[model samples]
Target: MNSGISGYVIQRLLGTIPILIGVGIVTFVLVRVLPGDPAVFYVTGPVVTQEAVQAVREALGLDQPLYLQLFHYFGQILTGDLGRSLTTGQAVTVSLMQRLPASLELSIVAMTLAIALSIPLGIIAATRLGTWSDYAIRFAATVGVSLPASVLGILLILVFYYYVGFAPDPIGRLDPFVATPQSITGFLLIDSLLAGNLEAFRSAAAQVALPALTVALVVMGPILRITRSSMVDVLTSDYIRTCRAAGFNWWTTYVRYGLRNALLPVLTTVGLIIAYLIGANVVVEKLFAWPGVGAYSIDALLASDYAPVQGYMLLMTALFVVINTMVDVLSALVDPRVRAQ
Candidate 1:
C-alpha cells in the first residue's frame, strides 16, 4: 500500500512539471500575441512619443530579449514575485492576495451549497427512479445545466434588488466606506471572523451570498447528474444486492456501502465541476461587479496588463492541476485495481 501510494505520488508530481511548463508557455505566448500594447496604454498624451513608449517598455522590462524576459519572470515567480500590474502599478502578487480571498470565499460557499443540494437530491432521485421527486430533480438539473451564469446573475439581481429588496447592492465585495478586514490570508470573511469583528463578518457574508448562489446554480447540475448516475450504478452492483439480501436496510446499504463505491466516479466529476466553476465565475463576477480575482483578471486583460494576466492564468492552471491530482489519488484509493502494477 505504501509503495503504491508513493509511486502514485511521485508519478503525479513528475507529470505535473510538464503540465505546468506547458501551461506557462502557452499563457506567455498567448498574452504577448494578443492585440494592444501595455506600453502604449501606459503612456497618456495627445501626441504619443516613441521615447515615452520605449521608456514604459524598458521600465517594465519589455525591452529585454523575449527569452531573457521570460527567464526573469520565471526567476521572480520562483521567489513568489509575480511582478507588477501595468494598469494598477501594484504588485501582481499583492493584487492577487487582496482579491483572491473574495473569490475563494465565494467559491467555497458556492461549492458548499452545490454539494449540500446535489448529493441527497441525487440519491433520492436515483432511489425513486420514475417517481415525481426524481422527475422534478431531473428537471431542476436540466434547467441549471442549460442556464448561463450571466443570465442567472442578472435574474438574481433583478429578483433581489427589485422584487425582494433583500440582497445587497450589486457592486464590489463591500461598500467602499466599509473598511475591509486587515489582510490575514486575504479572505475577508475568515479574517473578519477571526478578528471577532461581527460587523465586518456580517457585511462580507451578506455581500457575498448572492454572487455565490449564482455560481452555485451554475455548478449544481453536473454534480447532481453525476452523483445520481453513480448512485444508481452502485446500488445495482452485485455486492449491493448481497447486502440487501442479507437483510440490510435500504438506507444503510445505500449510504454505507453503495455511496462509498459510487463516490469514485462522482469525485472525478466534482473535480471537473470545480475547475469549470472557477472558470465560469469570471462571467458571474463581472455581472455582479464583485472584486474577485476573475474580475481583476478581466480588467487586466482589457488593459493589456500581461503580468497580472499571466499570474491569473498560472493560478487558475495550478488550481485545476491540484484538484485533478487530488481526484486521481482519491479514485485510485477507492479502486484498488487502479493501483495494480
Candidate 2:
C-alpha cells in the first residue's frame, strides 16, 4: 500500500512537467502578442529618439526572432532564471519573491479563516437540517457566493474604514507609523511577532483584516456548501446508521464517524479554494493597494512587460499544479481506498 502511494505521488509529480511546459509556451506567446512596445514603456519622455528605443529593445533581447527568443526563454527557465523585468530592470524572480510573501500571508490567513468557520457551520447546518440555523447558514452561503469579490471588498472598506472608522487604512501590509520588524519571514504579522513587537503585530493585523476578511467571505461559500453536502451524505451513510444502532449517541456518532468521512470532500474543496485565493486575488490586492504578485502582474500587463507577465503566469501555473498535486496526495492519504484503487 505504501509503495502504491509512493508510485502515485511520483506519477502525479512527473505529470506536471508537461503542464508547466505548455503553460510556459502559452504564456510566452500571449505576452508577446500584447499590443505595446516595452521599450516605449520603459523610456520616459514626451519625445524619444529612435536610437534610444532601438538600444532598449536590443538590451531587452526584443530584436531576436520569435523562435530564438522562445528557445532562449526555455533555456533560461531550465536554469532557474526568469529574466529581468523590462520596466523595472529588476530580476523577475527577485521582484516576485519580494511580493509573494504578502500574497501568501493574506491567502493563508483567509483560507484558514474560511476553513475554520466553514466546517463547524457546515456541520451545524447538516445536523440541524430544516431548522432556522440551517436556513440561516444556507442563506448566508448563497449571499456569499453571489457577491462579487471587488464589490465586497469595496463595501467592507467603506463600512469599516469610512463609516465605522475602525478598520485600519485599507492600504499596504503595515502602517507607516509602525516600525517594520526585521524581515525574518517577510510576513509583517509573523515578523513583528518574532521581533516581540506587539504594537507592530496589531498594526499589521489591522491592516490585513479587511482584505483578508473580504477574501475569506468570498471563498467560504463553496467550502461551506461542499462541507454541508458531504456531511449530509455521510450522516445518512450505513456506518453512521450502524454507529447509531450500536448505541452510540448523536454527538459521538456524528463526530467520530460522520465528520471523518465527510472531511474528504471538504478537504478537496478547501484545497481548490486555497489555490483560487492565492492566484485570483488580483481585485482584492489592487483595491487594498496590497503589494502582491497579483497587483504586480496587473502593472506588468499594463506596461506590456513580457518577462514579468510571463513569469507571473508560469509561477502561478506551477503553484496551481503543486497545490493540486498536494491535494491529490492528501486525499489518497485520508482515504486508503483511493490509494488502493
Candidate 3:
C-alpha cells in the first residue's frame, strides 16, 4: 500500500511537467503583450531623451525577439534566476522572498480560521436542514459571499478599532513605534515568540487580525456552501443509511460512514480557495498596507516592471500546480478508485 501511494505521488508529479510548461508559456507571452514599454515606465519624469529610452530598452533586453527572450527566460529559471527588478535593481527572487512570508502568514491564518469555522458550521447546518438555525447559517454565508472585501474591512475596523478599541491600528504588520523582531524566519509572529518577545508578537498579531479576519470571512463562503452540499449528498448514501439502521446515533453514522466520502469535494474546494487566496487578497493587503506579494504584483503591474510581473505570474503558477498536485494525492489516498486509476 505504501509503495502504491509512492508510485501514485510520482506519477501525479510527473504529469504536472507539461501543465507547468503551458503555464510558463502563457505567463511569458501575456505579460510582455501589455501596452507600454518597461523603459518608458522606468523614466521618473515625463521628459526623457529618445537615446536614453533606447539605451534602457537595450539594457533590459527589450529589443530582442519575443521567442528568444522567452527562451532566455526559461533558461534563467532553470538556473534559479528570476532576473532583477527594473525599478529597485533587486533580484526578483529576493523581492518575492522578502514579501512572501507576510503573505504566507496571512493566507495561513485566514485559511485556518475559515476552515475551522466553515466545516463544523456546514455540518451542523446540514444536520439541521430546514430549521431557522440552518437558515441563519445560509443567510450568513450569502451575506459573506456578497459583501465586497473593502466594505467588510471598513466595517470590521470601525467595530473593532473605533467602537471596541481593542484591535490595533490598521497600519502595517508592526507599528513603526514598536521595535521589529529579529528574523530567523521571516514570520514576525513566530520569530518574536521564539526570541522571547511576547510584546512584539502581540502587537503584530493585533495589527494583522482584522485584515486576516476579513479575508477569512470571504474565503469561508465557498467552503461552507460546498461542505454543506457534500454533507447533504453523503447523508443520503446507502452506507450511511445502513449504519444508521444498525442502532447507531446520527453523529456516529455520519462520522463513520458519511464524512470520509464527503471530504473529497470539501478538500478540492479548500485547495482551490488556498490558491485563489494566495493572489486574490490584493485588496485586503492594500487596505491594511501589508507588504505582501499581492501588493507587490500590483506595484509591478502599475509600473510596467516586466521582470517582476512575469516572475510573480510564474511563481503563482508554480504554487497552484504544487497545491493542486498535493490535493490530487490526498484525494487518491482517500478514494481507492482514484489509486486504481
Candidate 4:
C-alpha cells in the first residue's frame, strides 16, 4: 500500500458514494419499520384521542408520504442538516457534535492502548514461535475475543472501581465533584492540557481508564492475532531471510523491513477496529455511562426517535467510507501488489 496515497484515496472515495447512499436508504427504511412511532409514543396514556395523535403526527411530519419524507431526508443529508430529535426537540446536528467528541476521545484512547500493548505482544508471540509464551498469548487473545464487551467492562469496574478503589465512578466522563476544564477540542485531556490544567486532565483521564481498558481488551484480540500472523508471514519472506542472512542489525531489520511490510493488514484491521469503536461501543458506553454518540443513538432508538437514529447511521456510514478509504490508500502505499492493481 506504499505507492501513491492521494490517487488511491480518490479512487476509493469515488467508489464509496454508492455504498453510502445505499446505506442511507437502508437505514431510512429500516428505522421506519421499527416498532413505536415517535408520534404514537408521545401521544400515549389516558385521554389518548385521535386528534391528539394526528396533531403529534403532523408536528413531526409523519403524515407525509413515504417518498416525500425520504426525498426531504435525502435533501437534509445533502445539505448537512440532520433533522431535529423528535423526542428532545434538540437539533440532531448539535447533539451529535456535542457528544461526538467524547466518543472520539474514548475510542482514540482505547485503540491507542490496544495498539501499544497488542503489537508488542503479537511481535513477541511471532518471535517466540512455538514457545509456551506464544501459546499463552494465543490463549489470552482467544479469551479476549470470547468475552462480550459489556462483561469485560463490568469486570473492570468491579476490579478497579469497586474492589481496588483506584478507578473513578462509572457515572459518566468525569467525577461528580470535579470541575470541567474549559472546552477547546472538546477532548477533555487535550483541552485540559491546552488550558494548563493538569488536574483537570488527570481527572478526565482517570474516568475513562476502566472503560477504555475494556474497549482495548476487546479490540486487542483481533489486532494481536492479525499482527502476529502478518509478522510470522513477513519474517519468513525472502527479503527478511536475506536481511537475516546478511546479518543486518536485529532491531533495524525488524523495524525497517519486518514491521513495515507487516503493516498493511494491520492498518486494515485498525481502520475496522476504529469504525467498530465508533458505532458498536454501545454496550460498553452503557456500562460506563459514557456520554457517547452510541448511547445517544441507543436512547433515540428506544423511543423510535427517527432523526437521531437515521443521522447516527448516516454519520457512521460516512465515517466508515472516509476512514476505510484512508486505510485503502495506506495499504496501497505499503504493498506494491495493491499499488499495481
Top TM-score prediction, candidate number: 2
lDDT of 1 by residue, 236-258 (tens): 88998899899999778888887
lDDT of candidate 2 over 1-341, digit per residue (tens): 47877787788778889998999888988888878788886676788989889988898788999889999999999999998886787999999999999999999999888888888899999999999999999999989889999999999989999999999888799999888899999999889989999999999999999999999998899998998999999988899888978999877888777888888888888878777777799999999999999999999899888888888888888788778878988988888777668
TM-score for each prediction? Answer: 0.90, 0.95, 0.91, 0.94
In model 2, the runs with Cα more than 4 Å from the true position are 44-46, 245-250
**Model 2: colliding residue pairs:** none
**Where does candidate 3 stray beyond 4 Å?**
44-47, 238-251
Backbone N/Cα/C clashes per model = 0, 0, 0, 9
> lDDT of all predictions, in order shown?
0.84, 0.89, 0.87, 0.88
lDDT of 4 by residue, 1-341 (tens): 23356666677788878987898789988998887667878886789888999999988778999888999899998988999997788999999999999999999999999999999898889988999999999999999999999788888888998999988888888877877888879999998889888887888999888888999999999999999999999899999889988999877777788889899899999999898789988998889899999999999999899999988987888788888877777677688898878
In candidate 4, stretches whose alpha carbon ends up further than 4 angstroms from where it belongs are 1-4, 44-46
Worst ten in a row by lDDT for model 2: 1-10
Lowest summed-lDDT stretch of 10 residues in model 4? Answer: 1-10
Q: Mind giving the per-residue lDDT tens digits that candidate 3 earns over 212-325?
A: 999999889999999899999988888877886788986687765677888898999999989888888899999999999999989988888877887887778778777887
Q: How close is candidate 3 to the true structure, as a TM-score?
A: 0.91
